[model samples]
Target: MQDADKNGNTNQTDGPEHSALLGRMLKGEKLALAKLVTSVENDAPFVPEIMEEIYPKTGRCYSFGVTGPPGAGKSTLVDKLIARLRAQDKMVGVIAVDPSSPFSGGAVLGDRIRMQRHALDEGVFIRSLGTRGTGGGLSRATGEVLRLFDAFGMDVVIIETVGVGQTELDIVDIADTTLVVLVPESGDTVQTMKAGLMEIADVFIVNKADREGADKMVSDLKGMVELNDCRETDWKVPVLLSQANQDQGVDEIYKELNNHREFLDTHTTEGERKAKIRRRHFLEILGHRFVKKVEMLAREDERFRDYLEEVQQDDANPYEITKTFFQDEEFARKIFGATQTKPS
Candidate 1:
């Protein structure tokens, strides 16, 4: 019998099946790409093999991460951006991560509803994901899905994060250009600063610019940017106003996106920024895998269960128990494979 996770994905798939799926995905098959993303999101058994097969084919697509507070019209702005990209004959992929429904554990805001005009466009591929009770505005599998889209030959991929809190700031670590959208009524300059928006925003946009405070909000963002030397490059963060509902000021956003991409392409610090992002991604993957391994060990290892029981009974200090556990080479070998050596 095969074991299943909370997502109900069983751990018995063969490598050849994933290899075939990857082959189809690389050939620009939309259905295959969707299936690959679903497998990654479900944490299927063959995901590591699938990723390895597609890893070499990635890094061609340029990504934009759009984020802001809820009800700030981010979806509408992204819809406009997609139209602009489509005008240039670009093949675009969109990953819209929405907040999960507390009751159903599914995506609450379906971005397709806002972007229905592109439903029949063969050049565009759109996918929506639920937060799945994870933090950082994105699901844990978002990076994998982004990689799949890149490998599937998307010219541009836009990742729209759940616009809920400052925790959604993980988008900055992944996007080539981070576009932080805000509205006049979303919050004030101080609140933006408090939300850590100044540090992550490569371009600040005041959507729904027809509102009364839109110009003032743009002015405030500019002043804040000038006051805070947050950017690592010489590229100045541009703050623009946009009424997305009317499709006004969106062309400027497209122009600025290209300008920012050009700046990064030629900037001396581009390599350093990429290196930092790689380091962050490495640590995140390591931490997640480590925790999952520990959980699996705790569930199956009788010794680990006994240790947990001792800790729960207050018969032994957890710190000492953990210290002893690490010093046991046999236990380490059993849990992390025979290749793992115990620390001195």
Candidate 2:
């Protein structure tokens, strides 16, 4: 597999068939799009090339991230949101990040089963991405998948994280707006407070509003939003109540989503927020590339294997070995393939 260079360029050449697939995807062929998505999910050798080709078509779609603890009715809310967007004649894409199946590494809760009502909607595209043991409540391919949806001309893309609280905060880096859903149960409010969800949420929702303690949870979130001084933006986080199954308060959620979008459009035009997102993306790509290169070397290079064997046999200090490995000029050349300069 070809890797990206220091200048973020890929030398991997795609075959004629791969080029044809990209062309078909650009022409709005759903099958072609599906194939490209599978390729991205699998981290195919030509992914960097595919992303480079489609990048210019991205940054046109707005993304929303819905996340919280389990059983907060996130999937139901996403279903309603998709319907609302489709009603406005918007092309919607949904990436439902679900728990991975241990045996097959596939999404345990399939997208088709979760949002079956929209399965037939031509304007709606839904995909399920397994967490695949990724710690951030999302698949490593999620950001790339979002780009795919954006380039596919989606007006709105929604990412629903694996209902894991706290560590699920990675969504804030990707989503333009994040809605943290909670239920009326006791301790849920305290958990949110302790988990720092208040800081990441643009909007806090107490779903299943008909249940006991819903009003109090809403009020608590509102109070937390008011007291949280870390927010540098003028947009006050709204805490709304909803019974997503009944579609209650969904219109309000939709309205707030539009309001937040407008706020971003007005405030984030070439601002630090956009710059920060771009920087995060760059770092993520760089980190992934480095890890891949190390893995490749471990598999293919005898020197790297020798180091690993030494460490495995406890014949060398792993940390010292790593330090020495970094100082080796030839090893650097092999890993990065960049021209090196000698010290004066």
Cα deviation in Å at residue 292, candidate 1? 1.7
- Per-candidate Cα lDDT values, in order, are 0.74, 0.76
TM-scores across all candidates? 0.87, 0.88
Regions more than 4 Å wrong, model 1: 5-13, 99-113, 133-139, 188-195, 269-274, 338-344
Q: What is the lDDT of residue 244 in candidate 1?
A: 91
What's the distance in Å from true for residue 19, model 1?
1.6
Please, what are the lDDT tens digits per residue for candidate 1 over residues 14-54?
55777887888888788888888876665665776677677
> Which candidate gets the maximum lDDT versus the true structure?
2
RMSD of each: 4.0, 4.4
Worst 10 contiguous positions by lDDT, candidate 1: 102-111
Question: What is the lDDT for 321 in model 2?
Answer: 86
